[model samples]
Target: MFFLQMSGFPGSGKSTLAREIAKFTKAVIIDHDIVKTGLLEGLELEGQDKNIDPKRAGGVAYHIEWSLVDFYLSQGHSVILDSPCLYDVIVENGTTLAEKHSAKYKYVECVLNDIYELNNRLKNRERMITQIGPVDIPEERWQEVINRAKKPTHLECLKVDTSQHVDDYIGDVLLYIDK
Candidate 1:
């Protein structure tokens, strides 16, 4: 069993790659964005915005995602966390949980450095409540955010160039996990 931690910017194809990997490995995916979006939508629907903001929703969502990860791993299922790895806390949690479950810890970082490409994808992609809307963040910050992405220092990380066809690099991920 393996716990694959996905890392990338908002429009860097983290979810797309995670889906492909899940299709092949049959791993259970606990998508952070989906959980956060659900929380935000529930609040908006119930007129409860005063109770929690998007930032808090993100925290709650990650908490839920980690719980699901631990649960699935404990049940003998491989798991994938489809989220940008931006914080040291995330790395610690993922690594510790993997060790606790005696599962291989895998990290895949989708690298998309082109701001125009990222913006175009973000602009046209299916809208999610917690997703960036039409590059709402300043373009200049995109590179900074990408540079700020975090990963485990001691693990061998698979750096996927997002411009390549998934068929090309998906095998590398599979081999990495199996290795």
Candidate 2:
């Protein structure tokens, strides 16, 4: 079994590429947005009057995500973990989890250098209940997100610029995992 983790900013096409790769590899996907949205929906269903705290929801979602990863890995299944993975800790934790399960770990980082294209994609996204919902990141905030994103270091990872065709990199990723 292999474990694939996707890291990127919001409009960088992480989820799209994750779905394509999952289809090709027959892997289960554990998406952060989906988990967080489910948590939010549970709160709403519980009749909680207060607005959900994103930080708390995110914490619980991550816990669930990791638990699912552990379950799938133990069952000898391949998994595609989809998330922004903006921090170093997230990347490190994923790597550690794969190691613990003795699964091939592959990290794919999607990036779009063209801010204009990224902004357009972000603006055109439709709201979905299954997703964390569309967030409008202004130019300045987008720049900040880019500045804060930490690329994985000292790891054999694939970096693809999503501005181009992401499918073009699937073969390369497969080859990397096979290695």
Candidate 3:
């Protein structure tokens, strides 16, 4: 079994690739968007979501996602966590979880370098409440996130150029995991 951690910008197809990976491997997907959106909606009904900052919600959602991953791993199931790899804490937590469960830790980074294409994807995609609709973040912050996206240096990281169809590199990705 494997614990695959997906990393990318919002419009870079993390979820889509996660779905494809899960389909082929029967891994359970814990999508951050689904978790975060559910969190915001539940908190919204309680009138507490307005003041819920992204960082706070992200922390909570990640804790919940990690818990689920741990549970699934304990049950001898592979898991695919669909979230941006923006922080070192995320990578550390995933690595720890994988080690604990004796599963291979796989990291895949989706890249869409063209700003125009990224903006187009962001605009055309069906968005969750927590997802950005466009490239509204300040340019420097945007560049920072791109720069911050990373994988553990010691492990093999699969960088998929998502400007092309996923099918093109999916087989190689599967092989990478299988090896």
Candidate 4:
């Protein structure tokens, strides 16, 4: 099984492209935002404002995100983890998990050639539910997430600018993986 970890800023098309790749490769997509939203549902967090502790939210998201990946890998299934993973620890975890499970791993970074398009997409995206829970996050939180996104190193990952046509983007990724 191939474990794909997609990292990118919000509205950079990581989720859309991750789903596309999952469809073509028959892999499961584990998205962080979707998981966090689900986890927050019915929870009464005081001042749960977007301005709340970002680190706390990030930690929650990290735990849920990795747990899903570990579960699927244990089941001998390919998984695509989609998130704005700016931390090296998370990336290392993905690689280590793949190694320990004897599965192939690839990190795909989705970049945006046009910032405007990314902003529009983030603001207008329809809710996308997954195993986590609700998929709708507050706009302010979304903005905060994007603002904190960091680019992954290039040594062991393939970077794709999602501003290209869908066919081209997919083709490029396929070719990259094949290489």
- The numbered model that scores best in TM-score is 3
List per-prediction Cα lDDT, in the order shown: 0.88, 0.80, 0.90, 0.73
Residue 145 CA error for candidate 4 (Å)?
A: 11
TM-score of each: 0.92, 0.86, 0.93, 0.78
Q: Ten-residue segment with the worst summed lDDT in candidate 3?
A: 136-145
Model 4, global lDDT: 0.73
Better of 1 and 3 by TM-score: 3
- Cα lDDT for residue 147, candidate 4: 45
Model 2 lDDT per residue over 1-179, tens place:
89888888777898888888887788999989889888888888999755767877888889899999999999999999898886677777788889999998888888887778886787688744544334566766665765565655777888787888867777876677677
Clashing pairs in 3: none
TM-score of model 4 vs. true structure: 0.78
Question: Which portions of model 3 miss their true places by more than 4 Å?
Answer: 136-145
* Candidate 1 local lDDT, 18-132, one digit each (tens): 9999999999988898999888887778887556767778889999888999999999999999998888989899999999999999999999877788889898999786798
How would you encode candidate 3's per-residue C-alpha lDDT over 53-171 as one tens digit per residue? 98899899999999999999999999999998888989999999999999999999988876778899999998888999877666556656676786898999988989889899899
Please report, as a residue range, the 10-residue window in candidate 1 with the lowest summed lDDT.
133-142
